[model samples]
Target: MITAYKKNDMTSFKIKVVGVGGAGGNIVQKIYLSGLGCETIILNTDSQAISRHRAHHLITIGKTVTRGGGAGADPDLGKKAAEESIHEILLKIQNADLLILVAGLGNGTGSGASPVIAKYAREKNILTVGVFTLPFEAEGKKDVAFKAIAEMEKYLNTMGIIDNNVISELVSMESSVKDAFDLVDRVVKNCVESIISIVQETSDVNVDFNDLKSLISRGGLGYFAKGIAEKPEDVDKAIESVVFNPLLTGVTISDVKGALINIKSNGELTMNHFREILDKIRAHLPEKAPIKYGLQKEGDHRVDSYAEIYLIGTTGKRTTDEVIDKITSKQTNWKNFEIPPGVRKHKK
Candidate 1:
């Protein structure tokens, strides 16, 4: 098992951002400028596409397409591009305490390569997290995006991933491409900041490999909530406080029946405390949902219960093996997910 460290004890973190032509490159550039203090590496297939936006730290991988840089016809080519890019990036990530991946899916490069990169990072025992963008419905790239999303969802169900709908939610908020880019830039910036905060602030709370695996496997954005309460009765109040606000409130897509609940504490995760927390959560969930709980003794912070509860959803029918097979079965053309023609001059 890989040894874990407290947040404060972590000395360095390395983040790699991969993109398929200009979109991925643009996002990586924004993240580099966000000033998170972590070592940053940018990986792309086309050197020419990212040449102007390249930073001293950015590293280009693979070859650019001489012709059309759009999504490829053959699926296998995408996987090949990703594998090669990841093989190169792995050398740079040797001792990184944390790995953050940024990319937009549906395109050949980012969609194809992300999973390979994620698998490699996990094998190295680095805590890997992905911040990915979904394609817009109107982009005529929906099928490509959907396939990529399905693959991503399948991979993420067993690994760490954070989904951001850039084209739909982020772009629609603004009128111009510049405005959309700025909005996405801000979102990516906030995400990087939050991650940095978690790494920098020392916490007695230890997130084990099992916990990380379980979290990335079964949890999604709606599964997370944060609040503090000292007593059993107060726990309900805490969850309620967050749920009352429409913006903070979220609903789970999965039934959550037969779901497992794991709780960790520096002290004891008492039966009484467990019941209190479980009951509070159940109050918001469906009455028939079956829940189970487990406890650990590592968290030791006083200002807060140092408590976090995660809910795992298992409604999807897709299996991990099927996803892997699909990814591996395809030929590695690597050229399909290239930058489109005439979209020159990468933007911030």
Candidate 2:
């Protein structure tokens, strides 16, 4: 079970999670309902989509153009709507110190509005992070999704990309389509919650706002995975969950530029537990890559000892400007959906 932190406890910094479009809205709703310590907002071109979810704020963009209608899977139309209604969007996010923009790329609203909003937030000097998902191969929207991701990467301080194909692979064969999607939502929620806990919750070694800002803001992509252990014997299980997380497929562990790890136990954590976990992680990291962690005692007491580990890792040194050049150059072909090599894809 995820624990919620009170608003009053957020005295150190202000964080806001803005969900855009259908997939984005669902993810934000989960985070909000989980009781994480942050403000939540839902933005969509479709009024009905916004109505379906509850958030701290519900906004309808491009009112003059879209008039509460859906973007109809048109990226151009989606971008126009956000551009026209940016004033309203700005109002809701002006006070946020950290802005996390969640969206599902390849469709109209998410693919279009996400980049526009992220760019504007950065202009206000707000630290921005983007958590996005690509469409499955069968959707045939690879071009649309990659284009949006490239654009978003140019603006966001750091971003995590989860291929729908990879997510789908995690579900059992008998699971429904909805089950596969829910798993994606859960994975995203865990990431947002873990990052919040790292900075918001008090720990023996706290990872503060500055620590987070520094690590993610570095040029590259971000990766997140979490695991839980019920006893001393389960430490390896927990480490494997984090180090070899299936959600982070295609990652080159050696390319990791840096990482931030958070560990929580149910009041019975020992030094050996910490050492075993960190040592295993350190072995995979580049010698020069910086690593930071926060340790605390918190979790279920169903067993004598319980531990949860959360990791966020970064790879490569590709700056946002560099990525934009590669994405926008005329040599690039949208039809082919060409992106930097090494991003794995799956077929069903």
Candidate 3:
């Protein structure tokens, strides 16, 4: 079982899981088995699509819009189904503490419902995170996947959303379908674990839904980062020295004046070590920029020597102006880009 200390005395946290089709069904099943100890709810736009799969904790939502078909064949039906799914999900998760979205890329249900669900959840004060899979690059679904990703990113900028891409290089290395699914499951579980820890453990370093939302919305090209020792010998020591538990999500390099650092620990954190790391980062900071730092403790976890830094970059109007100038310089002639003849039209 997953063990975690509770910071609040609430009876139980409500977590809703919304899946799109077969891919989403698979992810929800794995999360159900992960045993995070929260009340679970599941929503699938296509009920018939996931009828073969069963979960005691899931609550399937909406009727099937299409049978024995792919998402690309019918855009209108896809949008309608997604709208119905979101409506069902909102009604079920009114008092939820968290909403976890799981689905595969290039689909109408997953892509369409995710943003709407997230918007409603945030308005209800629910912490939201999305674990979505991307389509394989050569599958001719790149445009579909890209549009979905861009939409999700825009929503996340304004709301709390943490995403894991299933089509990464590491995921591609898996030999079998089961192996790929397992790898993706592990990554999603780890991310969930970290979020749970932050919520349950009262630490000075706790990250709230708002903080996460702000970081992701502004941070461009976000990637995870973990701390590693400058040097290593044995594997165990290496693991201990390098803090694998630290998950730095999303990073942006724009208009960032400085950062406010907060540290939390059960034990004493060496001020010198903390300063050393900060100093190294500050060297790169713009001159005369303001930086704030603090330390506190309230969590159950002990911190002999641990620190996780989330680097965020900010951008301003100046950056946009510069980009426009750079792009215009290379444009000798301008023409409206259009789709080639006979390309598949978006289905109504």
Candidate 4:
């Protein structure tokens, strides 16, 4: 068994993505399928849920309460189940250098247990990044959902929030809710993979794990922006698509304190191309905040003209509005819920 705190306790330099509950577990399976060069684990109250999932590592918790059945949307029961299995979770994450948590809030296990797990990991001083999905307005339990997020943000290095309503709107008109969610999982995976590439893969310019560590550890609500552009004219649109992506609750370049820019492009990427891209991105960001950049060159030479760029940054402080608001619309019926404290925004 991999022991905990094997590396430097504050940072592991290893990456682990843990998914809590059914929706969270489902997303974990998607990221696992991508083979992103990180350890992936799934935790759930349902034995059948774990059995069907494809992650190499799986933990079924709360078998006593639910008897391998589901949480039945009872968040209180979900939280209790996670407490019962905290020991196993601690052991599983003992050696992690960086932990990325995935889940869909508003449900029982994701909303209840995920925050508990994040708290334990943070107590160990592990760098924790959260990638979470909120339910559609139609779900009606925004109270439980946002509470879980606020609790987790107290310990997260950065958190990426994806609005399921946005996902629902962007997906094919004929798609099922499951299909829409699966598509949203792909968005989550892409954003997380972009971050993973920075730490795990070598870059021509070099933005190592240490840089990422410094950025997240300094304390702030995390923000991530990503876009792909091929034509020279599409620069603004590409960058806008990323920074102003609808998935983010209401975050912008203005929300973060520092920034890291990374480019994954073909060999055709030229100095002129990079400089223009950099200039354009910087033109919109605050003049005072520092920007760290790196480049990854791909061998594909089939007349490629597109580059995928990831801009990762977050503020040392996030306002209450940023936490509870959405980029596209207002929550007409969610007003009864109080804004949870210590909230961070994460978008995929």
Best by TM-score: 2
lDDT tens readout by residue for model 3, 1-348:
111122233334455555555666776666667665544455455555666665544444445654434344233455556565665666677776666666665666565556566567666766556555555545655455445555554433221112233223233332555664565554444444434433333344433433434433443232221222222222223222122211112222113443333344344435665556456555645655444433444322544334543332233112323422322232211011111223212323
lDDT of 2 by residue, 1-348 (tens): 111222223357889999999899999998888778899999999998789998899898888788899898898888998899899999999989889999988999999999899889989989988888778889999789878877877788877766677643344555566766776787678667766766766665566677778877875666676777778788887777666644433343455688788888887877888888888988877888778787764543532457888887666558555544432331211122211123223335
Q: lDDT score, residue 328, model 2? A: 33
- Give me the candidate number with maximum lDDT: 2
**Candidates ranked by TM-score:** 2, 4, 3, 1
Ranking by lDDT: 2, 4, 1, 3
Which clashing pairs does model 3 show?
Answer: 157-217, 202-299, 222-250, 252-313, 254-314, 254-315, 255-314
Better of 2 and 4 by lDDT: 2
Model 2 bad stretches (over 4 Å): 1-11, 249-252, 297-305, 319-348
lDDT of each: 0.47, 0.74, 0.44, 0.71
lDDT of 4 by residue, 10-117 (tens): 332588988888878888888889787899999998898789998879999877777888787888888888888889889989889888898888988888888888
RMSD of 3: 11.5
RMSD of candidates 1 onward, in order: 11.4, 7.5, 11.5, 8.5
Backbone clash count, each prediction separately: 12, 1, 7, 10
